[model samples]
Target: MLLLLDTANLEDIKKGIDLYPIEGVTTNPSIIARENTNFLSRICDIKDTIGSGRMLHVQTVGLKADDIVREGVYLNQLMGDNFYVKIPVIPEGIKAMKVLKSMGVATTATAIFTPQQVVMAARAGASYAAPYINRIDNIIGDGVKVVEDISRIISTHNLDIKVLGASFKNTEQIHKACLAGAHTITAPLDLVETLVNHPLTGASVEKFSIEWESVYGKKLTYDF
Candidate 1:
């Protein structure tokens, strides 16, 4: 599954990229608002840092269909082809998705809370549909099931859209999302870091190091 950091903090972004096989970065209005900087310049900085090959998802703040379309177009123009314009699954967003998809621009339908939303967004031509996993679980306790159902529906209908699960609270949620068939996930740095921070894993590594040192006279592998 593809993993993307759902943050706008440059340090977290850099560390995540350097420490993991990060596929890309994703940001919404809330994430961008936290930076409190020039919006365009900040996004441009992210573009340069992540470089051209990775996907950078930027959300549209507009609430109207026309305005959303214009914003999506502008983002594509500003960030290039690798940028996936993120739009909500509201009615206006569906309209904008159709227009943007017609123009061959990548679109990610966000703020999804139900299977119906996923179906509609996929039908509207979203390249990826992002379901808020933790948010839905908080509301109805079936977020992972929703993702699984969406995956089944997409596969049954042969849709090309991918499920990008978001809003995770912990590594367990991410694990469940992937097991439920999400092709990708976007999460904050803390939750992502949990993917590699198991206590048993650390203990096992330390034990292996001690055993190796005992047998090899504490010498490094390069020691002659």
Candidate 2:
């Protein structure tokens, strides 16, 4: 599964990229606004930090098909071919996806809450479909099951799109999403850090360190 950081903080992005095998970074308008910087400059900085080879998913703020297409084109021109324009799975977004597809621009359907939305977006030529995991669960729906159903439907119908699960509250949700067949997941930095952190692992390392210190009189490996 592809792991992505869902944040616009430069420090977090740098730290995440340095600490993990991050495939890319995903950002929405809210995330961009939180940084309180010029949109173009901030996005440019993020693209530079991640480099051109990694995927960068940016969302469009337009609500109409023509506006969405225009925004998608503008972002594509700004970010290059590795960019995936994130559009909502509404009617206008589906229409915009079709237009963007014809223009050879990649699209990711966002704000998805149902399997049918993914199917429609895929049919509209979106390369990826993002489902809000915790949001679904907040509404009393099974988020992981939705992802599993979406994956099953895609495989059964042979769709060419991937399920990119988003809006996670904890590492367990991410874990369940991946096991449910989500091809990718984007999460905040804290949740990402917790993924590999376990008390037992820390305890084991400490135990080993104590054993070594007891034998070596607190000497470094290089000193020995």
Candidate 3:
């Protein structure tokens, strides 16, 4: 499973890129516009930081297929190839996804609330389908079930599209997504760290600290 970082603040993004050991990033308009005004510059910086290693998923905001395709091409030009274009799950979005995919741009059909929507995106030749787990839970509990069901549908149909579990609010959702066999899951850095570490790790650290102090003075470490 690929771990996708959720924030786009430059320094925070760089930290996530360097320290989190993740697969890549996912940025929406809300995330990017939160701090910056230079969309092209910021996107290029992120792509450069990621270099040729990871996938950067970016959401495009537009009402038409041509508009979204333009955005995708601009992003492809600004960033390099390892970019995943995120399109909404509307009629125009499906069209845009097909065009973008045919043009060799990886397309992620976002805002997927229903398994039927997932089917449509797959039919449209999308590379990935994002189901907002937190939003699904906000409407009806058991958001993980959605991922599980979608995973089953995609697998049963043997479709080429992958399920990208997003909008995760906690490690539980991340855990459930992993258990449900999602192809990729994106989360904030805090949640990613929380999942990478467990309570057992904390308990072990605390226990080791106590034992170390008993045998010798407390040890300190600071490394870059």
Q: Give the winner by lDDT.
A: 2
C-alpha RMSD values across all candidates: 1.4, 1.3, 3.1
Put down candidate 1 lDDT per residue, 60-145, tens digits, no spaces: 99999999999999889989868899999989999999999999888999999988888888888899999999999899668999
Candidate 3 residue 68 C-alpha distance from true site, Å: 0.7
**Cα lDDT, model 1, residue 208:** 95
Best by TM-score: 2
Q: What TM-score should be assigned to candidate 2?
A: 0.97
In candidate 2, what are the lDDT values of residues 109-188, reduced to their tens digit? 99999999999999999999999999999999999999999999999999989999999999889999999999999998
Against the unseen true structure, what C-alpha lDDT does each candidate score? Answer: 0.92, 0.95, 0.86
The better candidate by lDDT, 1 or 2, is 2
Candidate 2: where are CA atoms >4 Å away? 222-224
Question: TM-score ranking from best to worst?
Answer: 2, 1, 3
The lowest-lDDT stretch of 10 consecutive residues in candidate 3 is: 215-224
* Residue 166 Cα positional deviation in candidate 1, in Å, after optimal superposition: 0.2
| Local distance difference test, candidate 1 | 0.92
- TM-score, structure 3 vs. true: 0.91
Better of 2 and 3 by TM-score: 2
Evaluated at residue 206, the lDDT of candidate 3 is 98
